[model samples]
Target chain A: ADLQQGRAKANACAVCHGQNGLASHPEAPNLAGQPIIYVTQQLKNYKTGRRTNEIMSVIAKPLSEQDIDDLALWYSSMQVEVKMAN
Target chain B: ADLQQGRAKANACAVCHGQNGLASHPEAPNLAGQPIIYVTQQLKNYKTGRRTNEIMSVIAKPLSEQDIDDLALWYSSMQVEVKMAN
Candidate 1:
């Protein structure tokens, strides 16, 4: 939950999830402002192979418990506003 | 879960989340192939005020527990393949 460390650790995530968790790619979920519990659980799922995505499974493989928490905190700290699909 | 009933109830979600839970909007997460536990928990969060979004909080307000399970099943039944960010 350290903002400074979280930001530093989130660089790799930004490559796909955007600089602020908005998702630069169509296939990636927008992580901005997602619940901390939700985000944390997902990474754990990938790490444990409960959920598998080609890239996520690989990316999540090396994350320690603290790394996962930091990433979740980084994303959760971002803000998002949902505009209904037109 | 009852697939037919789930599909029927998902009509409302289709306007934004797309027919098979591949969201039509960038702001909406792709639900296809997502784990049932994850989807169900999120809806419950929205319902209980543990999570809030302008549209989803209202949409979830009237959903019975059965309705939430059905909807989650419908989305989880769909498939997704990710190609990753370039």
Candidate 2:
């Protein structure tokens, strides 16, 4: 997983997913800090038709195994802190 | 899945999970608009120790089957809209 390459390739995802990985939109999921394997599996699911989303299908179509790993690593490495509400 | 009952019981979750179900905390997964069964299963997982989280374990401990269903319904009913990043 090459984070440098992942960061470079992630511009396309910035719009819906937010540059910080916290999605500004309600519909697009916030992907920051997900497990590496979870993010990787999800992208693969989109590519394999296991998960169906018009936008995701197109975005995931061309990624190679390495591409997915790099992207997953980049997203999962984002720092996310939780502040519990009382 | 009783929305009314679920809504009434959800005050405890609103702080971290957000009243809208898009978690305010990045560490908390969004629960709004998730499938009812998925939410139900997750709560059950917490109760059964299949998944472990400090706060969630305490929260899920006393819930009955009906309580879980009601809470799951409440969170899943939250409306979430997505805007694609371009």
Which TM-score values does chain B get in all models? 0.92, 0.91
- Against the reference, the lDDT scores of all candidates come to 0.72, 0.73
Q: A43, model 1: CA deviation in Å? A: 13
In candidate 2, what are the lDDT values of residues B1-86, reduced to their tens digit?
A: 67788887887888877776656665566666655666787688789976566788899999999989999777656544443222
Error of 1 at B44 (Å): 0.4
Model 1 per-residue lDDT tens digits across residues A51-77: 667799999999999999988777667
Q: Candidate 1 at B76: error in angstroms?
A: 0.6
Candidate 2 fraction of reference contacts recovered: 0.00
Candidate 2 clashing pairs?
A16-B85, A27-B81, A27-B82
List DockQ, one per candidate, in order. 0.06, 0.09
Off by over 4 Å in 1: A1-86
Q: Which ten contiguous residues of candidate 1 chain B have the minimum total lDDT?
A: B77-86
Worst 10 residues of 2 chain A by lDDT: A77-86
